[model samples]
Target: MTTLTTPTAARLAGITRTLSEWQTADWKGFLHPGDLGWNSMAGAEKSAADLRCWTADGTVVAIGMFDGEDLFRMAMDPAALDDDELARQIEADLTSGRVLPAGTVTVEARGALALRKRLRARGWNEGEPWTPLRLDLRTPVPAHPRDAALRVEEIGLDQADDWISVHWSAFKGTPPSSDDRRRLVHRWTTMATGPFAHLAHHLIGYDNTDQPVAVTTVWTAGDGRPGLIEPMGVHGAHHGNGYGTAITLAGARVLQQHSASAAVVVAENSTAGALATYLAAGFTASEPVTDLIGSVTQRHP
Candidate 1:
């Protein structure tokens, strides 16, 4: 494997735009606009690409960022490295100041276990701290939504405020500014046509007067891999009507129509209580991956 780093000062949007496309295309929803879990190296913006690796022939293989000696989103193409090769790369990254505090990695179950084993063998054991779970799309969902009043509808940009209000009210004390909410909704609307969003359905639930009550966003990797549901939310007052489950199936139907093999689902450890909603929607857990922050090397003595 060959690693390449370029030192340049360019607009953050310009550099990260390519990285975002690369992620949306190749990395399968790993570095989304909402996830700020990456390590920053050479002071690169957290939302953009800091370092990229490619196969000898120049095809990109892995992409990551570093903050001090920590790393995050260290995804590598399996065909390019064996266990020893992987270990060597990790070590080089650690000692060379290429990675920083948030430096961590995640892969599919088998791959994650393999890397975890390699890191352990190399004395990198902080812990198995994060347990991220995924939902496979190809599986058949229960034939129906939870109820009839639970209507699933596309959230137009005009009605973005309605959706925003639900989130604002849900979070209550921590409401964002109007501009922030506008940008947030714009991104969601953009996701309706995003690379991943291109083949999927994005939906929201509404109450009797057509006000949004719940929201769930789903999309595919464009490789027929499966669909993924993210940022699923139900307003504070509408929690018990099975709104979450109904909309989840609505998205699953879209996946099933595409002949997808699985749908992926993830929730941080703090949100374990919501896992039951997914379980009730006919989703089975594949594996749970930890979501960790800070650093073992820099923070630990």
Candidate 2:
């Protein structure tokens, strides 16, 4: 019997392990374990609270994370991709509000054909598309000309503040409040010390004036598995300076050092500039994939 339950710390670790094993040289648009690690920015406890797993015979077969109140991103074991029992169980829970609220919900299940087929039969439609890009780590990552002038550093606890500063400046575009800063610090601490810490690398780049201008976090599933660049950004003030490409190449180099088969990231199709940055860093783009959108009220029997 397949049962759905919120994960405890042990179960979450298991989910992370399974996700790592699921990564492949071929991009499948599945959830990366780094996605879970990135969510640690919300704090450890909250990250756990937002996760759910489906288990059968004492092993996790599917994992899901709620990305906000309406979007649920999920990945299943490759063996379970076409499992009808698991698909029906997931569909029922999703529609019955056991997993998400009883209303509109967006599910990112690009690799789960059975679940996606069920959702489509029940009236789900495609959401916005996202482009997946990858850099082969078998070859040395070509250096960007900007690499010559920028100093990239692998940061730790002492430099957590630097990471937080540039990350917020790049994404939020304003100074974070004291409370927000405190929370961001806690988030970084949790991630850096978490169970999967060995797989993570935090890097920050500085220009000639020693100003931190960009940041990236790279996570490896393990040797030979694809590595992920979950959230890479250049400070808004430094956008036109090629810092984005510089930081991205820095990340790919870290992945190669860790023996990753490839480095992968996803960008919303709307973010043309982000895609261009990866291209500039020697990454190749794959066909885009879209999330499945459905309303609970329209659930079919």
Candidate 3:
């Protein structure tokens, strides 16, 4: 359980780094407990040891853990092994504990196609890359988005339940049940205390009658960089309309008011149109390293 190691740990970490796929885990970037999409039953069983990673030679490569898209992050040590031989050894080490084990695996890569090609050759399926876009905060705010009828307003703290309901309804698909929605609202509301925390702040886009329809939450990373708008979406009934573009600008406006230099959005490739909408709102776009996720299930353990 103790990640504290001397020389041996260093070598294994070196190999893992050479064979690395993504680097977010290397930096301890775990998802918040209240974020949507994290499975509850899976969460209860995770512990520090689950984060404890090792090499085929029984050496520690890094320290970290993952829960689907929740609480997942890791870091590697490059000082431990020969750079040339790192990937092979580390790939073996990772598969040893079922990290990339069988079943239907979800792989997300935000940048680069070469690495994805390598992964594809190695039997891992690639997923569509979600583009990252940026909107200058100082730019003039354009007229509201024109599409389906919507009501945009600053959220009231007393409306946590409403936030949870709207987000749950908008984002419900595979994982992150209604229970996850409640916890997510709770985390965004009170439990989290950081610049990136937007629990107490958000922009709600509603239907003509003031019912919640689209939601966008704003938060800044600890590094004081541009604001981040994540998991923004509209209900199924509201898709293909200007609600997405309108609320995106609305959220960007809020972050700008808070003194953000720029606001960035990260979303699946399917969101390109939404990005275009943002451009119309005076924002620029950036191409991200796209990773295609694919998986081959082994018949037996």
The candidate that wins on TM-score is 2
> What C-alpha RMSD separates each model from the true structure?
6.2, 2.3, 8.3
What would you estimate as the lDDT of candidate 3?
A: 0.50
Clashes, model 1: 30
Give all TM-scores, in the order shown: 0.69, 0.94, 0.57
Q: Model 2: how far is 188 from its true place, Å?
A: 2.0
Write model 1 residue lDDT over 1-301, tens digit each, in one string: 6565532335343333333333321223244322321122113333344444433445554445432333455544545334556546654564344454434432221233345555556555443433334445545567544557777776656766666666665556355688878776665555443323344455678866676877765654444554566557778877788877777777777666766556666654456657777777876664555523332344222
Order the candidates by lDDT, highest first: 2, 1, 3
Task: Give the Å shift of residue 98 in candidate 2.
Answer: 1.7
* Residue lDDT tens for model 3, 1-301: 2123222222322333322322221211212211211222222223222343544456554433444532223334435322324444444433443455555544332332232344566777545655556766666656664534777777666766666666666667333567876677665554223322332246688888777778877754322235566557776666667777788877877766776666776555675666666666666655643443444355325
User: For candidate 2, what is the TM-score?
Assistant: 0.94
Q: Which portions of model 3 show Cα errors greater than 4 Å?
A: 1-93, 112-121, 138-152, 172-200, 206-208, 235-241, 271-283, 292-301
C-alpha lDDT (0 to 100) for residue 108 of candidate 3: 39
Which of the two candidates, 2 or 3, achieves a greater lDDT against the reference? 2
After superposing candidate 1 on the true structure, give the runs of residues whose Cα lies further than 4 Å from its correct spot.
6-51, 65-71, 80-82, 101-110, 121-139, 168-179, 186-200, 291-301
Which candidate's lDDT is highest?
Answer: 2
Q: What 10-residue stretch in candidate 2 is worst by lDDT?
A: 292-301
Model 1 whole-model lDDT (C-alpha atoms): 0.52
